[model samples]
Target chain A: MQPLPKELLIEASGGDIGAFEKIYRATSDYVYTIALKVTGNRADAEEVAQDVFLKVFRKLGKFRFESSFTTWLYRITVNNAINASRKSTRRRSGQVEFNDNIEVADGRDRTREAIEKEQNEARVRSMLETLNPDQRACIVLREIEGMRYEEIAEVLQVNLNTVRSRLRRARETLCSRAQQERSIQ
Target chain B: MKCTEARELLASDFLDGELDKDARGEVVKHLDACDGCRRFEEAVRRAAVDPLRNAPRETAPPSLWLKVRLGIEHEQERGVRAALYRVWRSFHVPWTAYAAASATAAVIIAIAVLREPLTVPGSTRASLTDTEGLHEYIEEQFSILAYQDTNGTGNGANGNGADSVNFGTLLEEYLM
Candidate 1:
């Protein structure tokens, strides 16, 4: 359940620790989950989420109240996630290892639909893992988070056309690789 | 739109499509016949839906969150320290320049004050003085100007010969 005391955000901005704790409690899950998906590492994702929240706290004085606090929060979360993923890639290679003989880790195949769906999901994830962080971010925001192109542009601090291009390229790569994987399987 | 264009539209232009019946029929017709395009559509569906629709959503562990929060706190402290150092550095600059200027001025003023006594142009001392005394006086003035130019301002009473110039020249020589 979401909280209703919108005044808490204002108090938090004014350096009230208790108010900030409330804001944190209200929004931590949304921030952390997005960071985790983008970074694919708990350590990196948590760091990113923490940085995002800290920045939100520190820079809260600059907030205009022109946009919804939620949208501003979303922007902070997405930017940190993207930054975390970039750092992770530099520190450790994030390339997907395509193992043709890989078994399902879950080890459950109850029905044909279930088996196909599992296989498809695994293949998609592995292929997604191969993508550069930006493409992975775009895929996550557009397909997973269901964010619109304009919203994505705002989060990324990019143009609408760049978002569109990245989306097309990500989809094309995922689809092409997925097709090849399925044919091989 | 043509069948080829229709595939691109279906790719995700479908999300934006308030396509009327005619365009919908055209897209359906193309899909029914084009195996390549239909497979492409399925691929799109699979990619868009699989991880988002099927995979379990994972959240960060509590301990991990604590670690990150701690790291950010440390970073904030460091950032504040760095900002303070930068401000200190900015304050540091002018004081150094002032000290250098003070030291230079002091040296120049010492040279001017400690300067050799000039013979009054028409004094009984000059009448009594010989050629060697006048030559020594000129050499002494040379040494004083060199010292003041290197060290401080050489403004003084004996307004002639090598060392005699304005305050501006004294500063310029100091600069040079």
Candidate 2:
């Protein structure tokens, strides 16, 4: 993600809507992406994104320019996504919410590449769903976002060892799941 | 390093490129020596890390911005309404009426207290708070007494003659 101008942040913190819009436009893709990846659902991602921006707007005034804005944003986004994911998880009683079989609109072109991409997406979602929320968060941050372990620790407000262990355990689960799927195939 | 330790490193720091030079060297050496650890590393990459790393980036829908904007505007309106409500509530307490009533009551009490001296018919109590006035008042009371004693009657020139007769009989009457 590109870094936002400090001036824009200042203006937005002072209640400038135009500056805030720019900030949103610049950061919303990654924010939404992070939310979607963590929650494994578009609807939940949308909700989390909306919540994150609102919270940012409300608390922007108190934001001391100490840390990178994206880091702060990642923290809020991940926390909200994790909570939403957990709620949906509980709502469905352990059933994963990422439905690979949902009907796509017929008007869209159904190319072979598109189908493969969709399948790959579904596979990734299934693999992610095997982990608990914390492990999933670590995987998404470390794997998807390519955030360093230290940055993940900062974002998740956990220690480096904790990030390491979560990633280790998460990948272990994924490797095992991959092996199991291969054997079944 | 054992297979377990090397595989753990592969799962975490090795794959993530967080390992230091010395530790990474040890893990690489272990992977080179052990087939199981090398396969585990490849599996970890194929299964977990690579899929996510290569997953296509998605943009937020255009509608998301609209929703966020509407939410922000709604929240601002709600905040303004809440602030206005606080101000309205403050004024709604009838503080003006309360303060007016309080001031009126205080004035009435003050007037009633102050007017008592005027109603006493030559009452010296207000002035008696002054030392000179108190001395003059006591002297006048004594003169009135002396007159009544000489006249051998309760009637004195000051027309407090009745008061003079009863004045010294009780300490309360004397002070009055």
Candidate 3:
């Protein structure tokens, strides 16, 4: 995400819809992507994104400019996604399966490339489902969003060593799952 | 470095490029010596890291922003209603206080009036009768006064040769 201007944030905090819309346009891609990756399903992702933006809209006034806006937004997005995923976990099965026939935002592509992209995304989502919400969050932030360990620790509000351990555990689980799937195939 | 320790670092700092120069060298030495640790690192990367890093970035649906805008508008409307209710409650509370204060004042005044000494004419209140021997004492004093008046030694109406007043009638007139 690009660095948002302090003036823009201040304006949005003062209830300027146009300014807030700009902020949304700028950040919604990563926000939606992170939500999708963490929750492992489109419906939950969409719900999480909506909730995240609403919270940002309401609580923008309290956001001190001392930290980066992306960090703050990422924290909110991850927390909401994890909570949504956990709740959906209790309501039905353990893991919410990613919908394979997910509609792409870019309708321009009906080619094999688009299909490949969708399949790849589905594979990633399936792998993420094998971990618990906490480990899944660590994987999404570290692997997908490309956040540093320190940044992830700050966003997840855990110590640095905790982040390291979670990422290690999550990757190890993914490795075993992959091996199991390959053997079965 | 042990294979177990090398594998931990490979899963985290080594793969993330966060390992220090010396630590990275040590892990590299261990991986070079251990085929199992090298295979484990490859497996972790293949399974977890590469696919996610290569996954396409998803955009927010066009409807999401519209939904959020509508949600915010609804929230603002709810907030306005809440503010109006608070205002109404503020006005309502003072009237309740006034009513309570008026009822309390009325009760206190009623109690004070009931507790005052009775001075009504011909009134025979139970409280007066309940006093210890007060009725007998009053009757005796009236009898003495009547006797004195009859002998023309008291300033009473019966002193002018009027028949001595009946005690009960005098007592009633005194009350009046």
Candidate 4:
């Protein structure tokens, strides 16, 4: 989607819903992706996505043009997403801990080589499940999503160094578990 | 720093190349000497890569984001419409009381402006000081009342008083 114009957004802040709708369409994906990545569940992502829009709608009138509209919206979404993830953490930790009987699916491969690769991948995901949501999210964003450290920091509304540090710590934790699994294997 | 602080740094700082040249050397030396830290490094590398590489690359369910965006705008539209409706509702009034007060005021002012002392039409009006004018009209009427009166002698110079021309007897004699 094309980036929404800041000028159109300024017009929208004066109560132009039609203009704001255009801005919403342009930027909703940007917000939703951050939610999906940060919160790590479709439902939480949806809730966070809805919340971002509602906040944007309510606060649109108050948005003075002191900062870039995109950056402002980015900050709001990041802040909302981070808060949602934190709340989900307490609930999520319970589910993972209490539901250890979560039916582990059979590894999806038959060939000897494919089975090994699938097994390794499965073990990786299992290990990742141990991370707190924020750290898990940082790992995903940095390694798989390939976002720059600065961009991740922006999406999480954290300092770039925080993003790097979290990534490193998360990686170390996962590596520790993987090594233990290797020892057992 | 103790091994503990160094471990914390090794976890994050080593990744960033943030360690001073000497600190970096020490961490490398420690990693060469320590089995625990090298495994930590290896685990961190795997944890960082696996999910990104394998956890499903998801775009949101199509048009869901579109719907949420439209929905917020719709909500905003309704809010403005509600405010406008409230302002419009405020303009309606109970007309009877206001109308009645206005009508009564108009009637009282009209009466005050129109009321005046009565005047006779088509008359050169006599001033209030002309009381003598009414008395003079009565004096002019004195000649009009002068009329012949029959004396009790009844103008009876006719030989006998009885034969005198009494008003009634004279009429009788004429008739005879």
Candidate 5:
């Protein structure tokens, strides 16, 4: 993604609503995608996304443009999603139930594709659930978001070695689990 | 590198291209010589990619922007209310202090004004005795006292009213 315009960031920091709206339009999807992957549920993702943006709005004035806006946003998104995921877990106590009323077009092929897509999404979410929040975040950033190890470390506010260890452990667990499932099948 | 070290690198650093030059050379040399390390590398790569490739890219709901906008509005309102509360609190202490001081001053002024009635002599209180009325009242009281004394209406025969009047006249004269 391209960096946000400096003029727009300055204007937004000065309370220009129009400029802030433009900034939101540019980055909201990026924010939402991260939140969705981290939280693994649409409602929780949306809530996390809202909180991230609200925090961004409140703290924009303090941004000194030292890092790219996307990097700053990534940090905020990851932290908020982690917190939201933990809170959602505590609130639901491992018994999260999602509404299954997805709207689908009327056709057999379309219905099959939707079902496959939903199954794939559920499988991915379950795979992510095996790791702790920190490991999950590092894996999601590295694998899904395609961020570098250094970038992941910066966003997670940890050392590079920590990022490496977390990713290694996460991948090892996932590999063993996948093999186990394959053998079971 | 040992097979164990190569396997550990394959899990993350080798796949991610994060291994240092020397480490990468060592792991690559081991992978080339060991079938198990190659298989392990492939397995780890697959494991890392499978879930990420399958995970759907969900766009936020269309109403998400509206929700965010509403959230910003609510936050701004809360900020304004907080600021106003702070301003009110800042003034509250001084306003309370001023009110207490004003009440004390009013009490003092009231006491000073009311003290005149208590300190006035009884003869002076009976008439608005400025100058002429004061002189005439004093002379009339003295005459009444002398007449009562000469008539031998001494303490046994005279009523308490006459005794009181004489006493009042003497007290007023002494005060003057």
Candidate 6:
């Protein structure tokens, strides 16, 4: 995703409430999606999104515009999501609350397609839970966010080789788990 | 490339298109020759893509924006409170330390003042006697001075009075 223009960021940094609101509206979904994938739970994802934006708001002035705001936001979101995921794991004993009430409106009066979509999403969320937080983050960023390995390295603050190895191991684990599920099916 | 090497490359760098042309060619050739490697590659591809494509792009709930706004407000509130708290603490800590030190010094001074007389080695009654003896010695010295003055001057009024009052009688009278 493209970063917001410098002028808007400057305005927001200058404490313009409207400018910050626009920034939030522009980026909250992206942040939420990442948080959801990494955390694999809606509630935790929401909390993570809340934390990321709050950090952004608090630290907006410190942003030097040296890097794209999206990259900076990604770093914040991923780190907070990882921490939130760990806390949620410990708190819930690995029990993800798959609350079905937060369904996306498909405009089909909740038809089969909507049900299938919900099921697919639930399955994907469960699959994401199989990997550790780091691996899940790597895979989510690489596959879902379509970030390059180098970019993932930058956001994850790891070396390129580490990103490669993490992606490889994460894929291996995920593939093996998929195969197991397939065979079971 | 051997199947092992190609599988490693295929899983990550190859899938990511990060492998160089030559490495890519070798992995491709291996995949072409080895059905197992091809299936593994396919499985990895599926594993990477299927779930991601199916996983919905969740919109931030409507309440999320409200929550974030409230969070920012709360953060601002906290920022103000924290600034005020720091200011309070900055002044409070030193004053508290000074007050504590002053109290300690006062206690020490009081302890020293109150303890000095009690800490003396002699008994209280003996010290009273010593005070009485000092008073008696001072009275005797005064009496001798008065007697010398009267006798040396040959003043009968004073001489007679001094002669009439002996040291013992004078001391007894003073005591009485």
Q: Alpha-carbon error at B20 in model 4, in Å?
A: 7.4
Tell me which of candidates 3 and 4 scores higher on DockQ. 3
- Which TM-score values does chain B get in all models? 0.36, 0.53, 0.52, 0.41, 0.53, 0.46
Model 4 alpha-carbon miss at residue B78, Å: 1.5
C-alpha local distance difference test of each model:
0.68, 0.85, 0.84, 0.65, 0.80, 0.81
Candidate 6 per-residue lDDT, tens place, B134-175, comes to 576668768876765566422223336544533345565476
Q: What does DockQ come to for candidate 4?
A: 0.20
* Native-referenced DockQ of model 2: 0.58
lDDT of 1 by residue, A5-100 (tens): 668878877767677767777777777767766776556777787788788878887877876687788778877787777766745333322222
Model 4, A2-88: lDDT tens digits are: 346778877777767678777766776666766766664556777887888778878888887775676677667667777887888
lDDT of 3 by residue, B1-176 (tens): 88778888999999998898999999999988999998988998888889888887898899999999999899889989999999998778577889999999999999999887665355453345456446765787799787765665554344455355333466665863
Let me know the TM-score candidate 6 reaches against the reference structure.
Answer: 0.71
Q: List the residue pairs that clash in candidate 4.
A: A144-B52, A171-B44, A172-B44, A175-B43, A175-B44
lDDT of 2 by residue, A145-164 (tens): 88899999999999999999
Ranking by lDDT: 2, 3, 6, 5, 1, 4
**Which parts of model 4 are misplaced by more than 4 Å?**
A1-30, A65-71, A82-129, A133-169, A176-185, B1-6, B16-36, B53-57, B89-176
For residues A1-185, what per-residue lDDT tens digits would candidate 3 score against the true structure? 77899999999998899999999999998999999888877677888999999999999999988888889999999999999988887542333422333354443567877777766876887788789999988888887788899999999999999999999998888989999999999
Lowest lDDT block of 10, candidate 4 chain A: A100-109
Quote the lDDT for A21 in model 2.
98
What is the lDDT, from 0 to 100, of the residue A126 in candidate 6? 75
How accurate locally is residue B50 in candidate 4, as Cα lDDT from 0 to 100? 41
lDDT, model 2: 0.85
| Per-residue lDDT over B35-114 for candidate 5, one digit per residue giving the tens place of the 0 to 100 score | 99899888877776666855655677788889988988898899899999999987776668889999999999999887
Off by over 4 Å in 3: A90-98, A101-110, B93-176
> CA lDDT of B4 in candidate 3?
76
Q: Mind giving the per-residue lDDT tens digits that candidate 6 earns over A4-73?
A: 8899999999778899999998888889999999988777889899989888988999999888889899
How displaced is residue A162 in candidate 3, in Å? Answer: 0.7
Give model 3's TM-score versus the native structure.
Answer: 0.73
